[model samples]
Target: MDDGGMPWATARAVGDRGEDLVCTYLEGLGWAVLDRNWRCPDGELDVVARDGEQLVFCEVKTRRSTRFGEPVEAVGRDKAHRLRRLAWAWLEAHGQRGAAFRIDVVGLLSPPDGPPRLTHLQAVA
Candidate 1:
């Protein structure tokens, strides 16, 4: 069976590619990436970086098409809450408690035959 449309492995690969693209895009903006695929009991953080003096936890949503909706629309309030909790866990794990941080969402629409489109939203929650 397929996940949504693509197989599970294919979907995961696409998501990974999207995260890679987001990481490069952030680096291009001069952000130093601290981690990728950081996971805890609560959940996983797609990307973590330092933007100037602030820490950023990025959630990546990738879609092969927008037939259902925009990729960013995938992040709902529940997901945002989970991300916030995961951010705290990450900070604690890295001995960065009480650090200034924000949540960001990177949405990628990767068409099968065209270049991927990226959208970055900062301070989402």
Candidate 2:
């Protein structure tokens, strides 16, 4: 919602909605969502979830269209590196010591007038 007075209402709305969708879906898959839109010095992680034995840190990318590329392809090397660092911060802050963790990417392709397509990529780091 904070766009620094430069309103990107549609984008923000879509992003928020997509994140909610991801959370719901992940919960159904038995993952406990710990945080949404977590911001650290390294970067922001879209979702921090726990899937049983592993702490799953997720990066979510949603797009109205795949004209440019698939949503999953958006997380490049720099972003991946930042996510790794953020995961470290998350682990340390939660007093969650020495659990196996992995990076996951959830891509939501929400084309207008259709259901959103979600693809989960595991261990994307």
Candidate 3:
């Protein structure tokens, strides 16, 4: 893991870059990338994608290692609530209120080839 930026700053950078890799991964799996960093009062979602008729709200967590637990597990109840609200805002603003949607998590382990993973949990929060 790089240490150029402050702890949080570096981590955010890793996650931001990692989100791009995750988006590419998803796109390869037939998911179409949509809005990225869609922010509202309920925090910010890293990426949004479309799989057929379902909209996917993605949360990206990047870490040097999994010493504590899986990166996606970091998304707790509070964050989930905010993401849900943000999703709602996204829906209303995009005039997609009636469309189907779901939530997903992208776990990115830094250092490029260090076992980056994706755990997609549908319909969260």
TM-score to true structure, per model = 0.96, 0.89, 0.82
Q: Give model 2's clash tally.
A: 0
Models ranked on lDDT = 1, 2, 3
Q: For residues 56-117, could you state the per-residue lDDT of candidate 3 as single tens digits?
A: 99887766666657677788998888787888889998999967788777776665555665
lDDT of model 3 at residue 87? 85
- lDDT minimum window of 10 residues, candidate 1: 1-10
Worst 10 residues of 3 by lDDT: 1-10
Candidate 2 per-residue C-alpha lDDT over 1-125 given as tens digits, one digit per residue, 9 for 90 to 100? 22224358887888788899999999999999999998877678899999997899999988877775778888899889888888988888888767689999999988778999999999989
lDDT (10s digit) by residue, model 1, range 13-119: 99988998999999999999999999888879999999999999999999988887889988999999989999999999999999999999999999899999999
Error of 1 at 72 (Å): 0.4
Relative to the true structure, candidate 1 reaches a TM of: 0.96
Ranked by TM-score, top first: 1, 2, 3
Report backbone clashes per prediction: 0, 0, 0
Top candidate (lDDT): 1
